[model samples]
Target: METKLKVGDKVTCDKFASLTHNFVGSIEKIYENSAVVEILEHHKDDTVVVSDFHNRAVVALNHMKKISA
Candidate 1:
């Protein structure tokens, strides 16, 4: 389902790795079919090592769920 997301709204996003299945962050910006999620917290997934990767990522809107109103 298409969950309406807004900037600064807390949300959890689905990732490729099971361990990182739900990463928490806030919406930074919205695009056509996706939004930019600023990674704030997540499970320590060894398989998907993202130690050096940027915190911000563009994820599909369908892959995200609002955690806060």
Candidate 2:
């Protein structure tokens, strides 16, 4: 299902590698099925791997969810 996401919304999404469990960021831009999330925090684990994604990434709307305060 597609979610209606707006800019500046805090969300949690996954990354390709880097042993991180989840990536926290605010929506920077929105597309048809994806949005650009400006990563603010990256929670990493013990395993390490080089990832292509940096400060921001185009994440699918379904893959992202609202962050509960």
Candidate 3:
């Protein structure tokens, strides 16, 4: 089911440790087992903005799921 989620796909993750993600973003890039989500925009998970990130946060593919249009 997770495999259906691909690069550029939008997702609504209900369980991402601390945030019930309603945020929408594209899968900027992917790897053999992970991806780099260039978080386009977030609603409330601004715990740390990308601008604040010293380095890009490449999240595990499992941490995100593709959402419908």
Candidate 4:
């Protein structure tokens, strides 16, 4: 099933790649299978990767869950 996510929506992304923990952010842009998330909250251990990506991450739609409120 496809998740109805949109820009400006708050979301959390499951860990992937070198990321050691999940993270929270807002949707900045959307793609066919992923969205660009602007990092708002994240694990301290992921600081390096989060910063490296300029506080943004391209997270797959399936890996993201929208925050209700």
Which prediction has the highest TM-score against the true structure? 4
Number of the candidate with higher TM-score, 3 or 4: 4
- Name model 3 segments beyond 4 Å from true: 13-22, 44-48, 54-56
lDDT (tens digit, per residue) of candidate 2 on 1-69: 654578989998876544457778899998998999887777655123324455677888888898842
lDDT by candidate, in order shown:
0.76, 0.73, 0.57, 0.90
Error of 3 at 27 (Å): 0.6
All candidates' TM-scores? 0.76, 0.71, 0.58, 0.90
Better of 1 and 3 by TM-score: 1
Hey, what RMSD does candidate 4 come out at? 1.4
Q: How accurate is candidate 2 locally (lDDT)?
A: 0.73
Question: Model 2, poorest ten-residue lDDT window?
Answer: 45-54
What are the per-residue Cα lDDT tens digits for candidate 1 across 1-69?
A: 656678899998887543455688889998988988888887776224445446777888888889995
Weakest 10 consecutive residues of candidate 3 by summed lDDT: 13-22
Measured with C-alpha atoms, the lDDT of residue 32 in candidate 2 is: 90
Order the candidates by lDDT, highest first.
4, 1, 2, 3
lDDT of 3 by residue, 39-66 (tens): 6656555546545642234667666667
- TM-score of candidate 2 on Cα atoms, chains taken together: 0.71
Better of 2 and 3 by lDDT: 2
